[model samples]
Target: METTHGAEHVHVGRDGWLFLTAGSNNVVGQFSRSRLMARRVRGWRRLVVARVRGCERLGCRYLHVIVPEKLTVYDHKLSAGLRVKVRLSPALRLRRALFWHRSARRACLDLVGAFRAVRDARDLYFRTDSHWSFAGCDTAYRLICAACGAVPKDLSGEPQEWRQMAGDLGSKLTPPQSERWPIRGLQRDAVRVHASPIVELRERTGRADKLHVGAHVIYRNDAAGTDPRRVVLFGDSYAHFAPIMLTALIAETFAEVHFVWSSSLDWGYVERVRPDLVIGQVAERFMFELPDDRFDLKAYAAERFGTELAEAEAKSARKPGKNSDKSPGKKPGKAGTSVAGP
Candidate 1:
């Protein structure tokens, strides 16, 4: 029952497991039985209902997934000194609030229960990282596909390799700890067809975290056995637009998938894409701020990177014998890297 304080925000638990107890989101505070949390639960219920109705009008199926924090799923690994109840999780609270809604059954995925059911079999999340491992991501992926009535692809057979790296939580320690995480060698059939200007600029500058609010990318799968539906996913780092995470799994399952790196939904983009399915994924800790669904990703990107983009374009134009018709920056070589928050 011993708990040792490692970094400023990390709660060092038994067996090298690190849990995030404090940070910008106040991870531990979220489990409190307060009036504020009650109101937030109601707000989330309304938001989910609104999303469901909106998607219905567009003849699109919708699913809202809240990726539970490691503390919620693996609290047993935490020290006895840490007083937090997994039942008080905001995700569970929101689910309870939405229980009366008619769309509840179809609009939300029960990840908390799913994770708890099989957590003891293996490590679903990284020991020292805040993000989930391939096993955890795959679990969610299967649930998503099942909810969408799509056949889930079995990536377990994919080639795998191990690599040691310091995760977000581990890096916060005085002497950073590293773990050998399993890297899935996925033979991805989906190819990146498009990336927004901001993504391109950030990639070129090696600052993928800059102006990341509106980063967007599209993947198209021409492989056999893929679902013949289009999907638009508005999510954070958990469902990243990379071959190694949830986005790639969805893309491999569907014919086309658009990944927007934002928690807020852009209805206009949804209307334009006219996807057959719309998915919104958010981390449980970010339930504090409710999104207004007024996010214009393009405008946000323009506002943030307009000056830099203009400078790059102008600089390129000044070069003699250079093709000005080409895009201002070179195509991004790899997917943008994301570090999970505490």
Candidate 2:
């Protein structure tokens, strides 16, 4: 993790890169490709210039700043479902192609398991909007419980209900261009997931990794006492689930669990935390964001693994098979010399 100018750090993963942005500026690339395309292309340039020129003509220089402010407030009011509806369709074909790629398919399986875990626990997702479907979250929650050796709660015995709570996240994404994708408001009914009280071992502090939180704040019962166990989690939304899910699962295994993300874990954090097991998880399409110049995944992994596993794999690959002449106990025979060769 590279510390930025503002005491903030950038997180890179084994197969991922860290793209650092300026202060208080959100990393918008976490969305679908259409959103990224719209923000980075010439189309966005024209849109911005036009707005700036319009503001100049009105002699309201601050209007340039006000436009973004207005849009951000507008987006904050909308739900990710509405935002995704508008944001994903334009890139549907691209996303579909990505979803079919071998790597992408593998990624989805990892995520699907995570989703399944959440659902099996009778907790789908937030009732107001954003994040995974309550159904999707159930899948993730279950996978984690199993992985951590925790006894999973049965969905059949848990009854889920929903109540509308006022949320401000949807209105926060104000894209500059009107030619952009469709955006919408948060849903009126969201799933209210209920589970055992999370034991928050570490008090929730603002200093604790913000990148790990992303759009959702996870809570756990930390009162279980402290014992250090190693955990490696990867992905955007997928990685975020690890902290909350494992806090539950770890209770069954290690007394304390160290949570790290592929997206945000820097070499520094790895060196400092020194977790025993590392997990890498993410959505299928996230690979597109892997080429940031700011982070070194190779160095990070090298530090984390300490060159042992790499050397072990190389050694194992060189061992001779039973049929190979190079086998220590087997002697080489001529083509027709063997008893069965004739």
Candidate 3:
């Protein structure tokens, strides 16, 4: 296998595969056995313990999921020139650390093992993009359902179409590479009931990437056979609020599903929603930083985009006899709603 360095951030592997060796999170450097990396792993263990205890106090079941990066799952595709060791991945280190903690051990999901078992079967992640494909998302979804003790919804029969696109990793190259990947249909049984103000503003201005940090949304499924439990998911792009990925899959299976696009858990929001299950999902690279679980979605949006949001609302109010019904700077849905999808 021949591997070439394409861009400063991308590692071009054989057979049209692209791996992200460097990015904002310093993907390859995170594998070091340095003292700092060890401390980071310890912090993750503490965070897991706190999450479990916090959920227990709120009378909800919490499941922590760390979505492995492309390099962790597809290391075999890499060229011998790449010297990073997959075994040194932070995700594995964190999992090993959490294994000793009683409560945290059970809360954390072992996705690395799950992904490795089926890595040779098919392409779990996208060839050009840093995110997972429909197949990869489905594998994680099934594992999530089993952990929650909820019956999984089979979306295999859903209509699918392949579209040409350059994913996040592919776009970083000097000569961008593109691929045709399968796109699944929207959730048949679930409908978006509400979207937060930031979400609306992002859609209006076509600046999803910029305004994605605190996005949130809600989906309701009234199907007869769906699970009765309510689910709150604090995740990044992989389990987005969109109907094409992990959020959509969970929404279709449960009565109500709330998707919060933040790596940090908002304790206040969790208490208010009172969901039966709380899920925290983050990309493996993001494990480099530990969150304090104090993220307030509404306060964050206001502080970050106060002026822009106000201007947008004023513009909408100025339209011919259009009166703004949404509360000033408040999310539009029932209580809590924001958005995320990539």
Candidate 4:
């Protein structure tokens, strides 16, 4: 049991490398290239389509960013036992899912390959945490800007350095294992904070981590950057590494930036923000249940507009010779369900 990180889901590998158990059913098979689960991939594709159509209807550009799994970037570190379990690859499964939807295919971009190109030159992800290192976040920022068509100032010369700290995962461990490790992070001077970041709303209760009531703020230099546009970005903890940093670097490019911590899409908020670009991102392991898949949009709509919607549905149900509108208020906002996350 000590070999596992949490819930027997993480496998301790060589040189302190930690890999996630591939399929939930086979937690013991760490780094196993097991067969692709076509059904789950299909479900993810469907959700992507829904999100794309919904974003299009809102006149927003949609871009899906997928965080690379640790093993994906560091497969070489896998133990021989798990490494030889070769059967199927999740990366390929994800690619198959990507090709299933031409729309998502074209828009969705995974950074594992990109990271590989420069990984030897610099570390892109944390050695322990599921999140990326600041260097990785910087790379993602560049990619996101390119996707959003936001030209940023040359920061290659920007000062950067490595900081030693206990990451989220390492902190969970005890004893000598909890020792601080070096993580490539941005220099304080690199991130310029012209103004204080705002807190739009804090979910009063829920998981402490997800309770981070994020806000959308633009950071720009009056002397540079493209014209103002609008963007609504959503994601899991991975967003902490990319979008939030991206927001600081290219916020000026966007006329408005709405960054939601929740993986679920707040369509009502999307409508309210009316962003020109919409981005949803998540760590690769969590891709099994995409944010949109976990979220119940129908229920969210009812909860947000319940009273009037229920009234309207009841009126329609009573209409002579009309089908019953039994779906709307069957249960009071049960659809405002949870958006599960790590």
Candidates' TM-scores? 0.91, 0.33, 0.91, 0.66
Q: lDDT per residue, candidate 4, 1-342, as tens digits? A: 243345245555677765555455342332344344555566667767788888888887788776777666766767666552222334445556678578777677757667767876765766666567657767877788787677744444433444556565565454313333343233222222211111211112222343332322223223434546766667656554223344444443443444565556767667765778888876666655445434443354336545744565677688888768354222231122111111
Between prediction 1 and prediction 4, the one with superior TM-score is: 1
Candidate 3 per-residue lDDT, tens place, 135-166, comes to 88889999998988888878876447778888
CA-lDDT, candidates in order: 0.83, 0.31, 0.83, 0.54
lDDT of 1 by residue, 88-116 (tens): 99998888878788686567899999999
lDDT (Cα, tens digit) per residue for candidate 2, span 27-61: 33324455554443333223224433433343322
C-alpha root-mean-square deviation, each candidate:
5.0, 22.1, 3.6, 11.8
Positional deviation of residue 212's Cα in model 4 after best superposition, in angstroms: 4.9
Candidate 1 is scored at a TM of 0.91
Give the Cα error of residue 165 in candidate 1, in Å. Answer: 1.3
Model 3 residue 194 distance off true place after TM-score fit, in angstroms: 1.2
Please list the residue runs of candidate 1 whose C-alpha ends up more than 4 Å from where it truly belongs after superposition: 1-6, 158-160, 185-187, 209-211, 329-342
- Return the number of clashes found in candidate 1: 0
